[model samples]
Target: MSGTVIATHGLRKAYGAVRAVDGIDLDVRAGDIYGFLGANGSGKTTTVRMLLGLVLPTAGTVEVLGRPIPKAAREVLPRVGALIEGPAAYGHLSGTANLSLLDAAGPGGSRRTRKARIAEVLEQVGLGGVGKRAVRGYSLGMRQRLGLAGALLRRPDLLVLDEPTNGLDPQGIHEIRLLLLDLHRTGTTIFVSSHLLAEIEQLATRVGVLDRGRMVLQDDLATLTAPTGATVVTTTDPAQAARVLGDRVLTSDGERLVVRGSDPAEVNTALVGAGVPVTGLVLQRPTLEEVVLAAATGSGDRVAA
Candidate 1:
């Protein structure tokens, strides 16, 4: 937690002839909710397993909480909590019982302390009275909350979650988002991996997009979503506007025109001078979906067609 909560240098991993993670580098700052986003089979899970010491890397150095991974994971893992792939709990046991079992197997703490901690975490995760319910009887969202409570039992400094909201309803997703925001407010560094771009757009401060075992983009959400000085305009005369703008025009949307490299004043001036009346104009901001598609296709230009 001093310098970087998670850092990897030239991380590489291969399976037979296929390279899953190809010399990827990462630096996750303390107290940040870094979103690790990628398509299916894009090595997101592979990289996460390496960080947790569940799988060995072919080459590279990994440090979590300022200690080397796998070698020091045993020492460092106690201060870290994770819910990868899915929740881990016995179907036969009740939610409360599962938490108790984890508490006993975890770090050294008195029985009374453990009990109090369990109740506190259960409430924090919005599962206060449902602890007595059997795990098998609980809904998918309820199970997700229970899993998060188990992870928070130790009050870890760094939390890694994979698809945390995978099997949730809209309300359940909203609840989990609020819970994550609360945790981040309390100084916990969260590393979440998900295939849902919109979820990451709302929850994460910074994001890293991966495709085909390579990182296509890594930047803050604000930077990625900022207006790229492009405008989409609906006009009375599309043909006349295109002819006037010529090569400066990027594309057309049948009735509208996408013009690049022109400020608002200049766009208005050119349109009015050419006898083209503007019906509507909207400044375009890149969406996460758009950015991800652009990165995947290796096309830097914004698509307006």
Candidate 2:
């Protein structure tokens, strides 16, 4: 088996004449909380479906859990659990009943072991006492938790969740965040897809960015969030400062200049020597949103949606 729990090469999928997922590659290691990020219609869903063997790829090789996908999905899937798009549960059934049904259908295990596993997962996902309530009566967050518990019924080594935090209130989101952290600590590899940059920033150790059916960027969260040198903003003549700074200037935000690749001392030396006023100089660190947008657009422009 390779070091990566999930690996893909030249992965491609098309719907009719439109290429939903272009040739792409990915490597996700065990115990990683890899975030799949993209805007609406950016092919994130398609890519995930292909990975899970739900959608056949037109081209490329895919491997999950050390087995070739689709052909090996039946054997490999037993060790994988997924909650795609949203939670799946019988609305009329109580949470505990729903879990029981899933547990019965999952891979072979002793009856007592299965029951204990179900109970443990229920508690892990924060649905302990509420398991007796009908799924329809549960709140959106509770439903999400129940679905997660069902996925855990098989004791899967890998968990794939899509927009798991959608429709969750702030407190619910916090709860899920903590739950995921705990799961990661226990050596479960989590693969999550989300459009919410803030949520991904908080939970993901690494990120894969998709745009218009192409992967624009993939990197560790720390590198993506690190300061790209100093962004010195000044209240001097912007045009002249920009010319002096040349390619080092990132942009001008109304009466202030955003310079990159230059430290404060270098920026000040150039500005003061050029006879530019030193009214104000402030350094700014780039946010995750900024980093994602820059990579997606191939420019420093603000992202739409």
For lDDT, the strongest prediction is 1
- Mark the regions of model 2 whose C-alpha exceeds 4 Å error after superposition: 108-110, 231-284, 299-305
> Residue-wise lDDT of candidate 1 within 161-247, one digit each (tens)?
988887889888888889898999989999999999989899998888877677778888889988888888888789999998888
Q: Candidates' lDDT values, in order?
A: 0.86, 0.83
Candidate 1 Cα deviation (angstroms), residue 17: 2.6
Q: Write the per-residue lDDT of candidate 2 for residues 1-305, one digit (tens) a residue.
A: 22799899999998889988888898888878999999888888888899999999999999998899999987888888888777888999999888888777766545778778878889988888888888999888888888888777777789988888877898878888898888888788999988999988899998899887788888888888777676666765888888888888777876788788546877888889988877777667667898887897782232345
Record all residue pairs in model 2 with backbone atoms less than 3 Å apart, i.e. clashing. Answer: none
**Clash statistics: count for each candidate:** 0, 0
Alpha-carbon shift of residue 144 in model 2 (angstroms):
1.5
